[model samples]
Target chain A: MSSSTQTAQYNPAYHRFTLFLAICTFLLIVAGALVTSNDAGLAVPDWPTSFGSLYRIPPMVGGIKYEHGHRMLAEFVGLLTIILAVWTQRKEARSWMRKLGWFMLLLVIIQGLLGGLTVKMRLPWYVSTAHAMVAQTFFSLTILMTVFASRRWIGSTVTLTRHPDPGALSFRNLALLTVLAVYMQLFFGAGFRHGGLHFFPHVVGAGIATVILVWASFSGILRFGNIKPIRGASIAILGLLVIQLLLGFGAYMTRVVWGKDAVQPRPSMVATTVAHVAVGALLLAHCFMLAVQAYRNLAPAAELSPADQKAVVA
Target chain B: MKFRFGLLLILLVAGCSKNETPPASYKPEAPTAKIDPSTTATVSGVVTYTGDVPKAQPIDMSQDPACVLGKVPPNFGEAYAINKGRAANVYVYIKDGLGNYSYPTPPPATLDQKGCRYVPHVLGLMVGQKLRILNSDPAMHNIHSMAHENDGWNESQYPGGDAIEKTFNKPELMIPVQCNNHPWMKMYVNVLSNPFFAVTDAEGKYTISGLPPGTYTLGFVHEKMGEKTLKITVGAKEHAVAGPAFSSADIK
Candidate 1:
C-alpha cells in the first residue's frame, strides 16, 4: 500500500543525462545523414578502423571527413549509452525503466556493430538501410527516455489526479498510430536511399505520412491543447513534419532528377537530402514523446486518478 | 501481418539487386585542330563602361555556416564594376564569321573556390579544354552548371578534395555555375571552339590573339548590362583595338 501511495520522485541528474543522450542521438542521426549525403559511406573503405589504422593517418579530406567523423561520434554515443545503462541499473527505482535502460544499451551496441558492418561490407543495401532504420529507432528510444525522465512526466499523476480532465481516446489512438506510420516511412526512406527500387513507394508513403501525421497532431492539439506539455509536443511534431516535407521535395529535385547529369560535389543536393533524412529522426522522436504523453493521460476502467475516484465515490 | 512484412522485405531486396557497372574501355576522343598561322592578326582593346557603377554589396553567407572556415569572401554583385572609368568583367570574343580555321585547344583552365567564392569570377575555355575545379576553402563546394549548349553537370568537392576534371563538348557562350549548397555563390564559364576570347580585367583591357587576318564580327557580353556585336577587320598583322566605349545606353 505504501508503494502504491509513493509518487515518482524527480531525479534532476537522471533527467539531465537522458536529455544529453537525446541530443547525442540527434547529432548521431545528423552525422549519419552527412555520410550518406556526401557519398562517404565507402570513403573510409575500412571497418572499425580508418584505412586499417586506429588513427586516421595522413588525414583524409572531403568525403572521408564525414565518414570518419560519424564513426567517432557514434562510438562516443555508444559509450555514453553503456554508462547510462549502468547508472540506471544501479540507481533507478522503476524496474521496467531499468530494463529499458539495459535494452537501450543493447540497441546502441548493435547499432555500433551495424555501422561497422555497413562500411566493411561495402554498404550493402540491406545492411546500410537497416542501419539507418535502427538509427531512427534508437533516436526515438532516446527521446522516450528523455520524456520519461522529465519533471512533468515524474509529476504526471499528481496533475491528472487534481485536474480530472477526460481521458480522450482520440489523442491516444492517434499518437500510437502516428508512431507506426513514422516507422513505416523511415523504412521506405532507407530503402529509397540505397536504391532499393522503393523510391516510388517511398514518395507515396511520404504523402500518406504527411496526412496521417497532420491529422494525429491536429487531434492531439484539439483534445489536449490546454495542457502545456501536450501542446508543445503537438506543435513540434507538426512543425518538423512541415520542414521535412519541404526538404523532401527539394531533395527529390536535386538528387533524383538532377542526379543523373550532376558532377561531383553537388552542393545543394547533399544539403537538402541530408536535412530531409535527418528531420525524420526528429519527427520520429516527437511522435514517440506524443505517444508517451498520451499513455500518461489515457487510462480506462482501472487505476483511475484520485480525482476520477472522487467523482465515482460521489 | 508478419508474413506480409517479411514478403515486402524480400521484395525490396530483390528490387535493388540491379547493380551499376561502368562501361568497359570507354574513353572520349582526343581533340585536334589545325591553326593557320599565315596572315594571323591580334585584336586588343580597353572595355570602358559609360554607366553608374554598382558598388559591391556584401554577400550573405548565412545559408552555409562553414563558408567562413577560412577567410570570408568579399562582397559579391559585380554585375557592373567600374573603376577609374574602366569596366571590369567584360566578356569579349569573336562571335562568328571565321571560316573553317581551327586552333589547337589550350590546356585546362582553373576555377578555384578560395574564400567560398570562385576566384576569377569569369573564365573562358576551348570547347574541349578541361576545367580544373578546386575547393580551397574548408567547407564543401559544389559546381552546378546551367548550360543550354553543352552538357550540364553537378559536381561536389569537399575542402581539400581532389581537383575536378571536366570538359565541354559544345560551344556555350555563358554557362551559369551555381553553388547549390551556398545559393549565393555563383560564377560564369564561357566555352568557345576557337581561342579568340578574353575578359577585361581591373583596367578594363582585353586582347584576342591568334586570329586569322580577316573581317569578323566581335561580340561583347556583360553580366547585367547586355550584349553587343560590332563588325571589325583584322588586317594582316593588325592589332585592332575595339573602338567606341561600351555605354549602358546600348545595353538592352
Candidate 2:
C-alpha cells in the first residue's frame, strides 16, 4: 500500500482520470440497482440491440428505457476502464499502478461478459445475482485505484512504519478482516435482493459487518488519531455506516412490511433501495481505503522497536 | 473538470426516467366494429369427454374461513365439471387461416375473487383485451399472472380495493393466475390474437360467430382436460361446419 517511489513523477491528468473512473463505476453500480429493482430485465428482450435497432431512434419509454439506459452506461464505463488501463500503461511511471489499471480493466471485461450472460441466460436467478456480486467487486477495484492515485496518498513519505500499540491488535490485520467481512455481507445482500435463501442471514450479516467496521474505526482512532487520512476516513466510514443502517431499515420497511400487499414497490421504496445500494458501495470503498491506509501506515512487528514489538505477537 | 462533471450530470439525467406505473383499473372501451353481415359466418361445436375423470380436489379454506363462510363447506374449486360425458370450461377458438381482420377492443373480462376462489376457473379474451381482476374477499389477494408466451405481472389487491386491470400485449394459449396468499385460488386465462374464441358451457357447447369467409383451424381447450383442433371452411351467412364433432379421443 505504500506509494511507489516513482509516484513522485505523477501526471495530474492521469490522477484525475482515475478519480473519474471511480465515480463512473459508482454511477454504474447505482444504475444496475435501478434495473433490478424495477424488474426491467426483459424490457429490451434482446441484447446488443434495442428492438433490432442500433440506436434508440424510437425512444424507449417505461421499463425498456431503464434496461437500455443501463446498457449504455455500462458500455461507457467499460470504455473508460479500457482507456484507464492503456493510459496508465503508456504514461504511468510506476509498474504497480499500471498493473492495477489493467486488473481493473480485466475485471470490467469479465463483468461485461457476465452481464451479457445474464441477459442471454434469460435472467436466471444465479446469473443475475452473480452479476450484482461482480459489480460490487469491480466497484471496490475502482475505488482502490482512486485511493492509490490520490495526491495525499502519493505525496506522503512512509520512512517510519507505525505499528499498533504493544499488546493491541494489528491495525492492518483488523482493517483487512473488516474489508473481507463487508464484502461477504455484500455478497449476502446480492443473494437477498434476488430472492435467495441467504436473506435472513444477510440481515444478520449486516450486524456483524457493522460491529467489525466500528472496531476497525476505533482501533484506527487509537493508533493513528493524529494522522489526518486515518482520522478522516474513520469519521467518514462511521458517519456513512450510520446512514447506511438507516437506509437499510427504511428500505426493508417500504419493501416488506406489508405481507400480501408487497407486490408493487412505491417510489419511496425504489429511492431507498437505490440509495442503500449506493451507500453500500461508498461504505465498501471507504473500508477498502482504510485497509490500504493501514498497510501503508502500519508495518510488521520487525519494523517497530524490539522491546515494544516483543510485546506484540502475530 | 467542471465540464466533465457537468457532462456526467447530463448523462445521468438522460438515463433516468419515470418507471411504468403498476396495473390500474382502466379498461379501454370497445369501439363499434364494421362486420359485413352478408359475409359473416358462424362456427359451433361441442367438446365431449369419455372417461371417469378424477374427482375435483377439496380446497381447504380454514386458513381464511372468510373464503368459505356462508358458502358450502368444502366447496372445492371444481377442476372438472362435466355433465353426461360433455366437458365444460373448454376454450374453443379459431387457431388459424383467418386473414387480416381486426376486431374492436372488447371490454375486459372480469376475473372476480370471491369466497377465496376465482369465480370463473377459466376465462378467455382477445389479445390487447383488458382484464379486470377484482378481490371480493375481505382479505388481501395477489394476482400472479404466470404467462410463458407473453409478459407476466404480479399485483396485489386488498379487500374493497379497486379492481386491478391489465391487458396482454401478445397472444398466449393460457395464462395461469393464482392467489399467492390463498393457494387454493387459481384461474386460467386464454389470450388470443383475435376475438374468435369461446369457452364451452356446461353442455360442452361453443359458438364462435362473425367470421369472414375462409378456411380456418378451430381449437378447443378444457381447463383441467386437454385441447383439440378442427379444420373447416365457412361460406357467406351463418355457415356451420358439418359434424366434425370433437371427442375426448382428440384431446392430447
The runs of at least 3 residues in candidate 2 whose Cα sits more than 4 Å from the true structure, single-residue gaps closed, are: A1-4, A158-161, A165-169, A259-263, A305-314, B1-252
Residue-by-residue lDDT tens digits, candidate 2, B112-204: 987777878889988778888888887666577777766665555667799888888767776877664555566789988788888878887
Cα lDDT tens digits, model 2, A124-231, are 465567677678878888877776776766666544446544335677778888788877877787777876655688799989999999988887776677656677
Worst 10-residue lDDT window for candidate 2 chain A reads A258-267
Clashes of each: 11, 1
lDDT of 1 by residue, A49-145 (tens): 6656786552434555677788888888988899889988887777777888998997787677677666544455777887888799888998888
Over 4 Å off, model 1: A1-8, A55-58, A162-170, A301-314, B1-252
What proportion of the true contacts does each candidate reproduce?
Answer: 0.00, 0.00
Pairs in steric clash, model 2: B91-B221
- Residues B115-224 of candidate 1: C-alpha lDDT, one tens digit per residue: 77787778898878889999988777667776766655556676799999988877777688866455456678987777889998888988888787888898888776
lDDT of 1: 0.74
